[model samples]
Target: MTQSCVARVTAAYRRIAEADRPEVWITLRPEADVLAEATALDARLAAGEPLPLAGVLVAVKDNIDVAGLPTTAACPAFAYTPEADAPAVRRLLDAGAVVLGKTNLDQFATGLVGTRSPYGPVRNALRPEKISGGSSSGSAVAVALGIADIALGTDTAGSGRVPAALNGIVGIKPTLGLVPTTGVVPAARSYDAVTVFARTLTEAQRAVGVMTGPDDGDPRSRAWPDDVRLAAPSRPRIAVPREEDLAPLSDGGRAAFAAAVKQVEAAGATTAVVDVSPLLLAARLLYDGALVAERYAAVGEFIAGDPSAADPTVAGIILGAAGLPAHALAADQERLDRYRAMARRALSGYDALLLPTTTGHPDIAEVLADPVAVNSRLGTYTNFVNLLDMAAVAVPAGEADGSPFGVSVVTRAFEDQPALDIAALLTGEQAPEPLPGCGVDLAVFGAHLSGQPLNHQLTDSGARYAGEVTTTAAYRLTALGTTPPKPGLVRVGPGGGAPIGGERWTLSPAALGHFIAALPAPMSLGRVELAEGRWVLGFQCDPDSAAGGTDITEHGGWRAYLEAAGEAATG
Candidate 1:
């Protein structure tokens, strides 16, 4: 049954109450006000009104104004109650999305580390000890925790994508000027973009679609081209950083990235190594050079009003920006233009560039010890993106060392679709299922899971990971005698089998046809009932094939079996 907006939102509020992650929000709307908004939307739906985002709840970064909510931007003394919603938030509200309230962020959106917020650092959604990449920390965490369906964050130097990566959610850094920023508190006016965080690229795009177009209130807003086309090239050419550029990554991060690259290649794209030194140099300019002066220019007066009112680190950075002379700022601008041109040329031959979203994940303690240095490392791959005027989406590649690992799909400005397309492939998230859309859910028990060998086949077919599940206790799992050892899930009569673990993925109708047709013998697509009480097309082994395989059902899953094999070999 399709759930109503109120039901979904009520559940979300309940979840938020249970989470008790106070740092994720700066100002939460009264529960009554939130329900009231949802009730209004429900009434509108009853009246036969069409609402694209009916009942959707969204969290806005405190830097972005929402009517009646104080815009703190993580600095209490700088708070103000904006009488109106930001242009971006207003549009979402008009589409039937409700305001959940204001989320915390790095003070003035100044630092990449979430710890810069006076309200307290926004902890990683999945790992309490890790830093939630920021200044959009709280907004991203809110979405990652299901507290909101969508969250608005500003990206000056990867504020949006960095946090999304750390929390295992989707971050869409739209083409600059495509989404108006008039109501948003600017970090670097010219480079600032209102970004979106969601669980899937499809949902993010839906929000972006409603928010796109020029707004008189925002001079920075630009009209999208009439002929703008969203697409995914069947044979995309992907660009990767040279090996030396990957030195900053931890071993797990490197392996996760390598796995992502292989998935794209298996999906039919070819990869090329590119020297991104120039791009890295441009990134350094964002914080290390005179470019930071823009942040000073945006909020310097407020800092001067009362230095103590600002976060010490944020104040320090802005104060330093005050020292950059006009000539140095000019020099940095000139260098930026040169880097943009070079990047344009470097990316011209490829459909998109794939980059590790961050060098490493650091815990709050580590960031607090040496704030600037650690924050700089996090932006090593992201800071150059906006300066180069590109569109990028960060999607979770998989888990690395128990934390989420993500990669960004980047392309020239306005080429946002290709990035989304690649993200969907890598992350296994299908495009938003508009009415009458054609797609199918395909469940897999082994090999096709993220980071697993042969997982690339699903990606190549443009499949998306929908969720995980265990079959009804009517299946037996066994290790096939294949050279690489694959799992075969065979159905047995009720009570004659044990529940087996697996992942469920979605694929477009066209991709599904191709995927099923290419399956080898002993493995075929058939129905499997999930513990959730829904049946989906999933991997089923031929009964005869199970005869020659060793029963390993006690391990519970393919991954578990593999872990046992490795342990036995090492032990």
Candidate 2:
């Protein structure tokens, strides 16, 4: 039998308790209460209410308010319970997601190395000896460990993306103000973005989509522009930094990034190497220049009030902001504006920019030996993102010497879809197609499903999305042993079959022939029955393909299968 939401929550609790990574959480909800919330969600689903994130559990960064939970920012002296939920948390709750608890962070969201908290350094999810990357460390680890379906992290200076990259997960650092930061404790307020971390880009996208738009109390919050319609371009022009700019990368990191770049180029996108020295210089300003004053502006008073309670390194960095001359802040701001203009002109010709997420992955002991230096190194690729007001998605590119390697796809503010489109290409998933128009309705399964690896094949072939529909409980999905990991759908007898997830695309008659002619063995077009009793031409795999493949019928879809596989590896 399928697990109920309550059962999943209960099991997750047991796994978390056994995992015993105490440093990852500053405050956790009572197990009974969390299970009860899941039960309530299950009840709502049974009543036929529409909940996009029904029964999903999430972790809140300690810096954000969760109504009754303490917003500590991982600083014991700063802990406080809020009377109201953060606007972002409320949005997720309203979408049928439940909060598991508050995860730890760097003290007052001050550092990127994840070890500034009194709660103890956050250990990497896969490599315990390595730094988790912070100030959003715990939030990323919670999602990576499969303890949360989604987690919220604030990105002031790569806090969100860096952690996700280190932990091998998807981080959606939405455009500034797109997701309200009203209830968040500010860390350079102008640059702080409420980011979502999840195992897959689609999950992060869904959660983030719900949290976007204006929040009354947040002066920085704004609605997405009318012109920036959500969509993925069929073909994209991606920018890569010049070779010399990437010299800081470790050999393994460089090789992993090169492979990812090759994959993107093979997928039909054009890449151009451009000098980003000005952007790199701007990144230095985040810590080395007057921008550090913003940190002082946000938390200096707290450090001054109780100096002994602060982490030595975090306190030093914050306190150092005190003597910064006002003229320096103004000068750096002026300098940053120029850099932004330079970056805009540099990226104007491309849809998005692709870069290695981090230059290095340091171990916890190494970070402890030289906290500031190692932390600074971790932000080489991330620090410039929020300052430039761009949207970025960090996806796990591959592993490097037993550690996760990540690549970030960035685009100008509000043009998030193109970055995501390229991310799907890098990960071998299909980019979701735009809304449908006149054409023949054709059902699709496996990698061809919208937003899966091969969805671009349809969109590139001039197919338009018709709708998403599910199949009857007479089909099974299998994971074929293919190079890019495609799935095969097979019809089964009623007693053993299960409902399968799929999408419908509208393709012209002429396009359908070309699509089929290019399809490899074991996959062919055939009639498929929808759950609603309607029939449509769709993908089907030969029996021989399923003979040697793993039966993934339990996942109901390829996306779910991949997510499950990722979670299994984490355990």
Candidate 3:
């Protein structure tokens, strides 16, 4: 029997515990409570209720109000029991998503590094020693670790995007006011946005759709034009900053970004080099200019009465904001307005702008040593996003030396759908795999893993696929370099070519047919034997299609081949 979504989420939650929870959460709802929510959702689905999320498990950052949970914003003294769920949280629950619990965050939502929270720093899911980027730290970690399918985080200055980059998940900061922030504790009221974190773009986009719309409760909310609704663009013109503008990125980050740009171009998009200094200047205003005062304005009385209540870093930052002169604040506001206008004009001709989600990932110790400076650096690409009233989605570009690299797609406010659509193009959807007894195991040699070109063919077919898993030795992989890029697989004799590349995925017979029918020319589905003697759907190229292609078998896999090529070019 197929495992239910509730069952999958329960197993995921338990598995997280088995791996040693990362202290990403401040409070977890009792398992019983969660189960109750899940059971109710399953019943609703059985009754044919139109549920958008339908059994999706979601985590809320502690800063956002959830009716039964205390909103701590990672500071105990600042904690308050909200009378009701935040508007965003209410929307998610209404969509059939069950709240897992409240996750930790930067104290008062001040730091980009998750370490500032009194609850303890959130470690990177991929590398325990590294910091989980924040103030959406716990949310990102939770999603990355599969503790939840979707998470709600607030982004003021890169809080949502940075953590997602570090944790290798999708982080979306929708246009300001797109998701109401009425019950969220404000970091910078005008710039604060409820962000989404998910393992895949589909889930993230779905979550956003549920939470969006004009909310009378939030004064900033505005109705989006139906015709201009945010979705993936048919043909995208993406602007990229010149290399000189990205001087702060590490060697690995720069290379990964370049590769990502190439991938986007390969996916049929035109990329233009543009100056982003105006936006960067505006980002500076958030901390260095009058915006700091907004922080002071957000929680002044609470901090003034109990300085000990806030994290030292958060308290210090907020205190510094208090020193800003009123005139300077006015001047900074003027500067922000001017920059916003400049950004609108600059982005008028493009479908979206692409930038590295963060310059580089900093270690936990580095953040502790120079909390403010290091955190500011991580926000280079993200800080200006909300300030400019834009929508952004950060998709994993690829891994660089074991660490993940991500790029953000930005569009004018209310163009969230287009931004998400572009992101889907950049990072194709990888279907969720069925449980062991639910369906047959299949090995995919190409174009179905997250970020691959043709993965959407699998997701749209309702195939349940898991994250990437290496194949057993025995398959021969070839780079056919067909249109839109494709990989071919062929079985060889015993002890033939080593398992060059493959990912274990699954699909129902019906879904498999749908996936096959959607394939473009030059690519077809075939059964290929795995080393383990199992056979499943795999990409096969026409014999003539490999005529002019370079043999890359020695590199073992396309990813390895590309890595080698990049090293050679850079070296």
Estimated TM-score per prediction?
0.76, 0.77, 0.74
Ranking by TM-score: 2, 1, 3
Please write out the lDDT profile of model 2 over residues 473-498, one tens digit for every residue: 99988899886778888888665689
Q: Candidate 1 lDDT, tens digit per residue, 291-320?
A: 999999989988988999898888999988
How well does candidate 2 match the true structure in TM-score terms? 0.77
Of models 1 and 3, which has the larger TM-score? Answer: 1
* Number of the top TM-score candidate: 2
What's the lDDT for residue 100 in model 2?
87
Give the whole-model CA lDDT for all candidates, comma-separated.
Answer: 0.86, 0.85, 0.79
**Where in model 1 is the C-alpha error above 4 Å?**
431-571
RMSD (Å) per prediction: 12.9, 12.6, 13.8
Candidate 2 residue spans exceeding 4 A from truth: 432-571
Candidate 3: where is the Cα deviation over 4 Å?
Answer: 226-233, 430-571
